[model samples]
Target: MNLRQFEVFHAIMRTGTVTGAARLLNVTQPSVSTVLKHLEAQLRFRLFNRIGGRLQPTPEAQALLPDIDAVFSRLAAVQRLTQDLAGGRLGTLSVAAAFPIANGYMARAVASFLTGRPGMRMALQSLTTPQVVDRVASREVELGVVHEPVGSTEVDTELLLRSALAAVLPATHPLARLERIPLAALEDHPVITYLPQNLFRFHVDKALAEAGISPRIVAQVTVSLTGIMLARHGAGIALVEPLMLRSLDFPGLVARPLDPPVAFETVLIRPRGTPDSTVLARFVAHLRDVLRAEGLLPEGH
Candidate 1:
């Protein structure tokens, strides 16, 4: 009827006597007898017949034993899985990030995390900044990395890195001769930019506003990689963070630091009151180490 009842029945069937089942279960013989009686009453069938002071299992009990054993086996598996989750050994972490952060830093951090702790699983999704915040708030993602600081008090934010924005242009562009070009100087040229919905676009727009310049947008794309590719093909100059340009081998693209340098901040976000599990903490440390090695973190900070 219940797990305890089934367990008692199973033990009695194996041990062939109530007293032996009691010893196996670390209980009194009377307790085993009570459970066996209750199980047979609940099932409305005789599970055993007494023969020579031993329990001889009936045909019905013999037929039910396999199913009961299977149930207990699955229950044991569930127990083990719960233990593994609690121990931070088995579970899938849902991670959400803004585009380039997902591609650039988070990708490496996740790879390093898996290398250090194999068998841990993760599901990574790339989303816009607002989407990252929404996902964290809705408990869709256990951890989120995004460019914009989440405004909701329900989300805890940790500053990850502030990468300096660079001016990426075709190698033959005339401004390429200069060490760094001012933001206003690019207004007349066709400025290939990240889409307005992207986090990088938010930072770029804010910086341009601060610089008192209105960008003449030529083409807008979703990702930094796309912007760089467009810039390399002479679509227009792109404003992007330094790291985004690092892994690309576009021969025609030259990246120069913005003269009045603008920096974009990356923040790690999570739902407030969610305790930092061992897995998430390890991932945070791995991320910092990766950024530090890349010289993306502020000097001595």
Candidate 2:
């Protein structure tokens, strides 16, 4: 009828004597006997019979065993989940990241975090910067990682990494010989990069404008990895954030810095008023470590 009654009943059913049930339940024999008496009173049925100084279950008790076991089994599961959550070993961690971080640094960090937290589950989504920001603001995701600035009143952003932009060139490209690719030189050849609406694309346009160079825009990509892939296939030189280049090894693509050192930044975001979760904090810490190790994040981030 009640939790303690069910506990006493279960212990008695399993151990077969009041004294044994008392020992199993870590209670006095009289306490177990009193609970059993009260339980039978509430049920209005005899649950056990005393014979030869031992207890044996009656038919009603036998019939109730299956249901009691089911209840206790579910309670055990709930208990385990509580313990796991308290210890930071369970629950789902949802992250929405822009394409570049999702494909490169964030993916590596998630893999590493899962290795240490086998009981934890993850939901990683690849989205555009604005979409990631919206997800964070709407509480659809616990964390967000994006290079483009999409700050809002509902979400707080932290600068995760500031990385220099790099030129992704095919190994056989003539400009690959140069340690630093001049922005003006790109005018002679085609360029593959982010879409015009992207913040990085705006910065690229501004840099080229400042240098008095007009590059031939051959292909516009939604993500840095796609631009890198196009460059690997010899489509054109791709201007990409150095974060992807550090984590990804493209055999046919070589990364070169810009002559004037254009820089891009990645930001970590979470809902402004939401409380910090242990799992989210742990994941953020691990991501920082991974980024720092790969030289995407500065040391001591």
Candidate that would win on TM-score: 2
lDDT of 2 by residue, 169-237 (tens): 877889999999888888899888888877788888888999898888899987788888888887898
Number of the top lDDT candidate: 2
Model 2: pairs clashing at backbone N, Cα or C within 3 Å: none
Pairs that collide in candidate 1 are none
Distance from true position, residue 280, model 2, in Å?
0.9
Q: Which ten residues in a row have the lowest lDDT in candidate 1?
A: 240-249
Q: How high a TM-score does candidate 1 get?
A: 0.65
Q: Per-residue alpha-carbon lDDT of model 1 for 1-301, expressed as tens digits?
A: 8778988988898899999999999999999988888878888989999999999999999999899889889989999877766666665688998877787778887877777345689988988778889999989998998875567887999888776778899879999998989988887888887777665677788889988988788898877788898887878888866556775467867898886887767788999989988767766777788888887775565
lDDT (CA) for every model shown? 0.82, 0.86
Residue-level lDDT for 174 in candidate 2 = 92
What CA RMSD would you report for each candidate? Answer: 7.0, 4.7
In model 2, where do residues sit more than 4 Å from their true spots?
Answer: 1-83, 242-249
- State TM-scores per candidate: 0.65, 0.71
